[model samples]
Target chain A: MEKKRNMQSKELICTACPIGCRLTVFQDEKSENWFRVEGNSCKRGINYAIAEMTDPRRILTSTVKVTNSHYKRLPVRTREAIPKHLIFSCMNEINRIEVITPVRMGDILIDNIASSGIPLIASRNLE
Target chain B: MLNYELVVIGGGPAGLAAAIEARKNGVQNILVLERDLELGGILQQCIHNGFGLHIFKEELTGPEYAQRFINELLEMDIEYKTDTMVLDISEIKTITAVNKQDGLIQISANAIILAMGCRERTRGAIRIPGTRPAGVFTAGTAQRFINIEGYMVGRRIVILGSGDIGLIMARRLTLEGAKVLAVAELMPYSSGLTRNIVQCLHDYDIPLLLSHTVTDIRGKDRVTGVTISKVDQNLKPIPGSEKEYQCDTLLLSVGLIPENELSLQANIKLDPRTGGPIVNESMETSVEGIFACGNVVHVHDLVDYVTEEAQKAGAGAADYIFEEITEKIPAVPIVPQEGVNYIIPQNIRIDNLNGFLDLMLRVTSVYRNAKICVRADEKTIKEVKRPHLSPGEMERVRLNSNIMKTIRPKTISLYIDGEKTQYAI
Candidate 1:
């Protein structure tokens, strides 16, 4: 029997901007880092396709408990995109932490969240 | 009555940007009135990212995007009042508003910018046949509950409509540990951006049922399930195609309507197609010195476009206040021809033409390999070829002022030369 070649293609819609370019990414299993991207109008789509195929990540945005503010929750997001698989774990960790009021935008609510080296920062000011 | 050079209603992104731009252009004594308790408006509840990519050159969450403008307005010392609702507006640029701090105050302004934004279409608007249930909520209301009030609307959800808000809520509820059974869109193609469909549904494995709609709702006190049915070409629910999904909540994101009560009160002429005020190139409404932008003019897909249009209204208001705009030529009416839904700035003043005119429009349906052509009477002055066009995404075309001046036709019209088909299912 002959050995089979491990080659795959995946289609993705770029969410970087509203243009939503359709990207077709071809992956050669022989070389993990090599990816050929097609159907994108801009250069950003190439990077997006490659990043999406390998180590998929997403910016997690959710609300955190707050004290002394009229709002019960203050919105926060990971300073950078974290591993996609860890979103629920990160949310679980985020749910356990609460901050006092007078929080400013860009304030770090959690440094190195979920051991991902991504800080969770406030998205807006809470008074 | 209190007096100001410019008065902007609704302290959302549109009103904030308009007031700030007017101040920057030498307009003094500007006031922004917002009905919400906070200045951020609906953006405060929108915690998701993918905003401000065009204006800020970086992706920011909704609140972050609104906060930037709020900070700028605060830094510029522009006057604004939250929790204030404008009751009426007169044709002469007078505003009647009320708030807890200042009850029933009237203000006169040289220029007024209408930026009340838009409101979601509820279940009542769509008339989904079902029992009145407590679990039914608009997608925006659910967003406010989850992101703002820290409350989970329901454990199981069924979203009715594939608009951006519905798609976003699908992911939001799923991330919050709620099972979003599926999103049903009446149309064959989703009326939301393609990216939203992929990120919000595809990534999370949430099924999107196109050409389907909620025909009935079950449960007396709260929604226990919803009957989804396939619709035919005429958008009528087809018989014997009903499927039931057990869910506790039903979220409707059917469409948005521009809030134009004040516009009507001011005697501003409205375009029936857009359900917004008719204006010229300057963003000035039918009533002189009264401008409208953002969602009040029409529903916008992006906040960046809203900011750009609001800036035009702001600068136009400032120019009117300064008496700098002089009528050089009569305004030319812009007519939407075949394959086009409607065009903003229903008319254009030749003198008001800066360097170029940006015409924003949406096609009636999906088209491929289409040529959007702008004509001046019998001559085609501008044309651009697009590989793909959909009603979900808005399109913009820029016409040079030099070419516009040369033709100076009595009427300007826009039409698309292509075949319209349901190609986006």
Candidate 2:
């Protein structure tokens, strides 16, 4: 006895780890995106698919500005994720942008960065 | 030609312990070589606490935990060489080294142990297609900046991978007045420890985005922003649900790979599953007189385990030198069963096996509840029920040598029940 395929399909291999997930990607027309997915055991696998197929992004780790603080620079993270293609632009803006003193962790360092609507704040606070 | 009775590669927790144990076991001539100027490996910069609790019975910062061993080895009159990089090690028990002061030196050893730790998987390793920006950093590197260098890396930061390091860094950045925004993890469940999630993210009100990841890194001279989205099970990006975060810095805490170049050059048999040397119950490698432990053997969450393994390597080396390993080596093959990823100590021959034989493992998937069993030739040798199991968390089980001897079967299988998957029958 053989189990028939649910509407013939192809397997999309994911490189989440060495354990590549042979996933079955089926388009669900409701959302109009790569709709239904299976064969991925981890959440990262599915997210890896959507990002790879359409657009991708990364969580940026860098510095922020401080206002007259003892420490000139402070570590920071973005309030939201940036566009996959615009990662360099965001970093370039950060490199050029410097603030003066009084920055704390979670403080808004840059608001509406490149109009992407993601805020960059200090990942760590400085005196 | 430099020579010694025992030559330990790496000065980390594992290497140091092996050196000390070897000395204690009457190995007079011993030497340790470290690539970094500092003897401690990743521990020196890990400033975060919660280390050494298992080994020392009290919580200590990574540096402090390393200090205890560093100070002990220092007092033991052990010989150590820092800033010495081992280029290669020969199967005949010879090691080549180059230092800033000493150009090249070949050292022969009676016994050698590979204790080199692991390295973090970088963005390049993950192959995130895009422009190479200035603001990208591994989470550990970023940690060194805020804690040691005392410099700001970026104003806006987006963390990829909700591992313990990333989660802790998210909270650290948030505390330092930076906007963490959220932690995006591709996996539905966080790969970090439960405590880290609760303390670092949940307590700080930082959101943990499960089933999400950063699809791209934007910016040229630096980072400008990034695009992220939820993924389907097939792990393909979905359109229309895409969202963007305008941030400068991208931090990756993807994963760690065991550093094992010396082992490879030594022609040591490597466990592909662990990317480390495969050792027997005595922690001896394929090479008669060589041994390996710690992250070099297999990455461990607790330093206590590293010390424990180092002691085994040390003791095994001592036994080999004293010609005590004489009994018939009851070899057992480790078979990774359903829903199980890999198991350390691929083989075991427990003659003087004492206490509990701790076997480290990784699960294939997330299981709400599972029971781990060690089966040998249709006989259950050991079993331990776990409340929950995830691939992110490494599992350790204990079995007495006395019990292991009962199933003198050649092959031993570790499998999980109660969680059904395609991989699991």
Candidate 3:
């Protein structure tokens, strides 16, 4: 006699670094932890796989309009990774703002962008 | 004619780092000549992160990484001229350049470093059969327009080739409310980093069509659509496997070529395999007192590696200026054997080597469970086991001075032994 088991699996490619590791996430219904990650080359991939299976996030980078600078746009990025689903909405908010010149690199252009609590900072100095 | 101890051409990451290193090595009066209005070169338009991981131990955007070098260079008080283009370089180290501020200026330098970097391959280079259209743009050009110029290229996009630039643009355009239909790569496996494939394409649900290429571009004044076809084993398009994607923009990211026009003017030797200058262990070119590094020597995958190589070139230039590199014997040749595409520092003067030597190479194809064997005569000097090897990623192996004592003064060879695998996406 055999017992029936509830098992779910998902395949993912870890994007923690350039050496993208293929990861397999398995969910065991009977286990207390429920999720187990396999095929990771390092410990970082384990967290990446689990986060991917749960709530995915990404560091959103884009350009914001600038004034009084030699260049027309200033490159900006989120201070931290935000929820993946908020990328477009973040962009929409970023596009609405125009920065002034003499903005230093790492200057906060937008605070709590898109209500994600991640500030958008300038990627370069615009003199 | 103005004179300097060292003259670095192209004030990008390579030139900046090289100049800084030379100054640090006690060689003063260094000057960097840049053709652009600013110092950062192509990095100014690369607004994305994932740079400086190895060097800084933290991820940074491209401009931020370049700025760190630029700030250091400025702090060192190294003189540099922006918007100055070097027109020619004589074998005797005379640099002729022109700029708005200093028109037709000539500088006599004791040592010169070439760091002119590379340029992207255009549509004509790949020869896509199509009528002349306005919507086609190279991936780098599109990146510059969108990121720097603050202009939208198109609302609908179809990118060809899976190189990192192409992959990044697919995400960039999509974030700006553009529809990225597909990314078609002629090769079965992407030539880009694996992380880029996952983040730029998979995350966005943009289909990456492997072994596929754009056969035709359809539009008169603007690109209305494109026809993509699956390629066969021979890399030829299959007869019946054709799909049409109606996109207004077609972005090409085929490849990048080293910018070595000035190297040719100076009659420096170039390697056809790497499409860059043939350098020694010291990063010195065939022309004495002339050193080259970074993308001008060979296209590098990482900016951190570029900085490291440029520092070597800078140190080499300083040593040449001070006459510190004493050649005790004729240089020995390095040979690339089966499964190896090419090796940098094509020749080395073993007597001038320090405690160790680092050799960088790329495999001819993808391999599984591979062993990279370095041989001096018949004996194996060093062997490293790699679980996986791909042409997309460069490999580096270090040789210690202890291994140099066993050499027979013959040619050194490097090759891979493993099960060759055709990379499939």
Model 3 whole-model lDDT (C-alpha atoms)? 0.89
lDDT of candidate 2 over B228-313, digit per residue (tens): 88978877767777788988898999988889888888788998888899888778888778889898887676777888889889
Candidate 1 per-residue lDDT, tens place, B77-195, comes to: 99998989899999988999999988999999999999999999999999989799799999999999999988999999999999999999999999889999999999998888877
Ranking by lDDT: 1, 3, 2
Q: In what order do the candidates fall by DockQ, top score first?
A: 3, 1, 2
Q: Give residue B418's lDDT in candidate 2 (0 to 100).
A: 62
How well does candidate 2 reproduce the true complex, by DockQ? 0.02
TM-score, candidate 3, chain B alone = 0.98
Error of 1 at A73 (Å): 1.4
Error of 3 at A54 (Å): 2.3
DockQ of 3: 0.48
lDDT accuracy of residue B400 in candidate 2 = 76
Each candidate's DockQ: 0.44, 0.02, 0.48
Q: Tell me how far the alpha carbon of residue B335 in candidate 3 is from the true structure, in angstroms, after superposition.
A: 1.3
Shift in Å, residue B132, candidate 2 = 1.4
